[model samples]
Target: MRNMILAVIGLLLLGCSGGQSSNSTMTVSGVAATGAAVSGTIFLKDSAGHELSMATTDGTFSFDVSALKPPFMLKASWGGKTMYSFAAAAGTANITPLTQMIVAAAASSTDLDAAYQAPSPTTFSTIAANLPAATANLRNSLKPLLASYGADMDPISGKFSANGSGMDGLLDHVAVTSVSGTVSITDRSSGATLFSATASPALANSVSAMNWANDSAAVAQDPDLKVSEAGDGLAVWWSYTGTGYGASVIQARWLNSEQSATQISTATGFAMMPKVAIDGNGNAVVVWMQSDNQLNNVWVNRYVAGSGWGSPKKLTSAVSSATGPSGVPSIAIDAAGNAVIMWNQSDAAVSSHFDVYTSQYSVANNAWSTPAMLSTGTNSAYGYKVVANNSGTAAVIYNQFQRTDGRGGNGDASDIWVATGTTAGGFATRTKVSSSANPIYGQGSLAIDPAGDILAAWIQNNNSGYFDVWASRQPAGGSWEAPKTVANSVTGECYSPEVALDAHGNAFATWEQQLDTEGRQYVAASHYSAASGVWDAPAEISENIGNTYDQHIAVDPSGNATLVWYQIESAAVTVRSAQYLQSSGWGISQLIATMGAAYDGYTVFPVPRVAVNSSGKSIIIWGTGSM
Candidate 1:
C-alpha cells in the first residue's frame, strides 16, 4: 500500500512539471548607430507588440527578452517619429544577433505616419519580391518566427513585409519610409546555421556621430538641466567659470563603435544661465544669458537633428542698452519644434524694476516675435521657468517680490505667479500658482502630462522653522485646482521639490527632506493617481546615508518612473536610483554603474537626473563640474 501511494505521488508531480515552459530568456545586443542614438528611442516589441526597452547609450544595449516566442521587433523612435525598425529571432545559449541600425532625420510625424501603403504580404516569399538580395540560409532560420507574425524578410530583396497580422499588425500602424543596413540573426548555442538578411543597400545611411557637449567644471554650476524626447537627450549648462565664463550644449548619442558628447555651441560671448528644449524630431533650442561687452542679453541657438547647430540669434528683439540687463531667461519647446522664451528684463519698460517678458519662435518663419511683457509690475520678478505641451499651450512661473537682489527672488518674501500662453496670443494674463499666503521659497519644476494636465511643485514656508513642498494641477481646458501638500506630513523640512507626470496623468514628486530623528538629509518621493485623486503616502528613497539629495524624477507614458540621486556614504558620492512600476511599486534601489564618481571636500555632489521612455528604458545621468 505504501509503494502504491509513492507511485501515485510521483505521477502527480510529473503531470504538474510537464505543464511548465522550458524556454529561457534570450539576450539580444545591438547598436543604435551614432545618429539614431542621439535622436531615436530604442524598443524591443514582442509577438503581442509588448515593448521591452533600454537606453541605447555607448552604441550598445542588451536585453534578456522573454523567450515566449521566436521573433521580435527592434524599433527606434524620435518622439512621435519612428526612426528605424529591425527584426530579431531567438538564438542558442541566450545569444541573439547584434543588430546595426542606420537611421537619419525622419519627416514630420504626420507625414511619417502616412507613409505606410499596403497589399501587405503575409509570407516571407510574398514580400520578398522587392529584396535587393536575400539568402536561403536567412529564410530557413527566420521562417518559423516570421510565420508566427505572418511577416518575413525576402533574402534576395533584403526587405521585410507582413501578411497583415501579429507583429505586423503593430508595424503596419507605423510608417517605414525607407530601410538600409544589414540585419542578421543567428543561433549561437552550437553549430546552428547563420542568417543573411540585407535590406536595401541603395537606401542612404544618413546617421552620423552626434555633436555632443558637456561642461567639465571644477566649481559648482547652478541651474543646470537636461531633457529628452524619443531616446535622445540634450544637456546644457554654463560654467561658473568655463572659458570667458561661457555656456555650452552637448548632444549625447550612441554610435556603432562608441558613445560620445559633441559640442554644438560656438557662440562668441560670456554666456551663462543656459536653458534648452528639444522637440520630438530632434530639433533643439538653447537660450542663454550672454554678456557681450558687459551687456546682458538673451541669445538663442538651434540644433537640427541631421544638420548641426545654427548661429546664435537674440530671442529678445528688444535691444538692451549697455546698462540694461536682459537675464534670467527660460525656454520651452513644443512637439512641432516651436519654442517660447521668457526672461526678466530691466530695459523692457525702462524702469529699474525688472518685468517679465516673452517671445515665441515660429517654425514656419524661423523667427522669434518681438518680446512681449507678460508681467507689468514695478516690482522685480525672478526664477523664470517655462513648460509647454506639443499643442502650443504653455505656462511660465516666477517668484514676484517688491525687490530683486539678483538671486532669483530666493530668500525673499515672494509669491509665485504663473501665466498661460498660446501660440496664437503668446502668454495671457498673470495668475498666482502658490496656494500659500505665506512666502513661497526656492525654485520649482513644472511638467505637462500627455493628457494636457499641468503640474507645478514648489517649496513654501511651513511656519515650523522648516519649509514644505506643495503641488497644484490644472486640467486640460480646466481651472487650476486647490494646492495640495505633497511631502510635508513628515517631521522634517522639505525643499527642492521636483515633479513629473506620466501620460496617464499619474504624478511623481521627489524632494530633499531633513529627517528629524536622524538629523540627516535624504530624498523623499511619492506619487498621485488622477483616477483615485489622492496622493500616496510619502516614502524615503534614500535611507541612512551620510547625505542623500539632489534627486530628479522622470516618468514614462506607462506610469513607470525612474528616480535618481546621489549618496554621500563615503568621500565619493555614488549615484543611486530606484524605479517605480505601476505593477510592482518601487523596485530594489541600486547604484547605477554608468556615472562617474564625486568626492566630497574635493568635489561638489553632481546633480543627478533621470528620464524614462514608454518602453521602460531610462537614461540616468550625473556629473561633476569636472566632466
Candidate 2:
C-alpha cells in the first residue's frame, strides 16, 4: 500500500497596536463557523472605488482617512474566502456582524458563495461528482482479498469482516508468534502485539490489517489503539533511538488514524531535537543537529508526497570543541519548507562562552543556504529560539551579555535581542528587543503568530529575591512591546519559560516555579488577550505532580493550550501533560510516560516540543534517556 501525507494552508491576518485610546474607534470582531476568530484582509475603499487603506497579516490598517469623504465600503475576507462587504460613512464606528460562509471540499472549484446559494441537490451532486477516485479504487482492489479471507465486505460503509475461515487466511499471510500466552510480531526496528481475539482464525479482520502489516516479518507493526476523527490524517515528525551506535538518528513519520505510518528518514549523528514544517502539497522538510566526534553540525531532509524519503543534506559543517554528550537544539521550518535552525556553539576563540548560530534550508533547490551569524555582541550568547511565518519571515531571539569592563564573572548584565528578515536571504542587522540595564540570564522560548509577529518569554533574576517570568511581544510592523511580568516567584525561583501564540494573537506561556518551602518545581501559565491587550491572571497548569522542571507550552490555532513537563520525585523523573479547556478551565494533569526500574543515574525524561496545524490538530515530540 502506498502512503501519502496531506497538508493544508490557510492565510491569516494579525493586528498589533500601541497603547489603548479613550477616543471612540471602530472595533471589528467576529467568529467563523469552525469557531476560529475571524481575521483576514480588510480593505477600505473610497466613493470612487479607490483603495484608501489595506490590512494584511496585521489586523488594523489605519490611515488619515478621517478627512476623506463619506459613503465608503469595508470589504473583508477570512479563511481565504470573502466574508462580507459593508457600506459605511467616515468617522462612524462600524462593526460587521459575523458572516457564515460555506466551505467546499478540496476538489471543488466553484465559488463558495455561489455554491451556497444554488439548489441543495445541485450542490450535493457537484460534491459527489468531484469525490476522489481513490476511494472507489481502494475498495475494488481489496474486494478479492475479502473473498479469500471469507470476510464480508460492505461497500457503502467501507467495512470488512471475517468470521472463521477468513480470519485464518488473513493470519496466514502475516507472521504472528505466541510470546508468554500473547501473540507478538517482531520487525527490524520495533515490536507489536496482536489481540488474542484478533489472533484467532475465527474472526475476519478488515482491510486495515493488510494496509498496516509490515512488508517484512522482521519489521514490527505499530498498534492502532486510538481511533478519533480529530487527529485523523495528521502527520507528525519525531525521533527514536533503536539498537545502533556511531551517530544519533532522528525520524519523521506521517500518521493517519485509518492507515499505516509512513517513515520519512532515519538520519544519523543528530540530536533528537527534530523540527518539521509542511507545505500545501503535503511535502515536508525536517531539520536536526548532528554532533560528529567533537564537532556539531546541522542537517536537513525532505519528504515529498509521492516519494518516500530523500537523502539527507548537511546544512552546516562548522567544526567546534563543544562536543557535549547532551545539548539541546532548536529549529523552525516555514511554509516554503525553508528551515532556520539555531544551536549553541563553543569554539576555541570564545572559550567558556557559547554563541548562537543559524543556517537556512532551501527546499526549492534542495540545499542549505549559507550559514549566517545571528548573534554578534560578546561571547555569552545562549538559549537561542527562532520562529518563522508562512511568508518566510523569521525572527530569532536570544540573550546576549554586554562585555562589561573586560571582566566576566557571571556577567552582571544581560539583554534579550531579536533579529528579523525575509528567509529569502540577507540578515545583517539585528534589533535589541529587550531593554534591561541589569538583565536576567536564562534560556527562553519564542513563537510567531500567522502575521509574522513575535512573542518571547524568559526567566530573569536581577538581584531580586527570586527569578520571575518576563514576556514581550513584537506586534505586526511594530517594535517589541515593553517587557511585562507574567508571573512572580515570591519564594522560590522561576525558570525555563516557554511561549506559544495562536492565530488570534492570543499568547499562552508556561514555566517552572520552585517553591522555597518544599524546593519543588510547579508549572504555571498565563494567557494574553488580544482584544483587551492585557494578560489574564496567572494560573497553575500542573498540580499534585510536583517537583518538575523544563516545562513547554503549545497553543493550537483555536486558542487551545497544552503544557508538558518533567516531574522529579524520589530521585526519578516522569513525564506529564496538562490540557487547557477554554470552556471549563484546565483538565487534570495526566502522566504520559514513566521510567521504570531501568532508571540510570542520569535523568530519564521527555523534553517536549509541540506544533499545531490550521485545523487545530496538535503533534508533540520529545526525547527520553535510555531505559
All candidates' lDDT scores? 0.55, 0.51
Residue 42 accuracy (lDDT) in model 1: 61
Q: List, residue by residue over 1-627, the lDDT tens digit for candidate 1.
A: 011111000111111335633444345444333122223456665444456766633334455664433244455454564433333343211101111211111111112122222112222122223221223332333443444345454321132213344333313232122222323222222211122222333111111101111233223243344444444445555543344344443332321112334444444556666667777786888887777566677888888877877887765546444226787688888888889888877743444467778888889998888877777555667667788877778888876774544333445576778787775468765777786466777577788875678888888877576678888888887888888887664577887788888887889888888878777888888889999878888888775756776788877677767777767775455656766656557754555422234356235556555554343435544455433
**Least accurate 10 contiguous residues by lDDT in model 1:** 1-10
- What local lDDT does model 2 show for residue 83? 40
Q: Looking at model 2, which ten-residue stretch has the lowest summed lDDT? A: 1-10
Candidate number with greatest lDDT: 1
lDDT of 2 by residue, 550-606 (tens): 677666666766666667656455556666645445665654444444433244344
Q: In candidate 2, how many Å is residue 114 off?
A: 36
Over 4 Å off in model 2, which ranges?
1-247, 257-272, 318-328, 404-412, 426-428, 568-574, 599-602, 620-622
Residue 169 CA displacement from its true place in model 2, Å: 18
Best-fitting candidate, scored by TM-score: 1
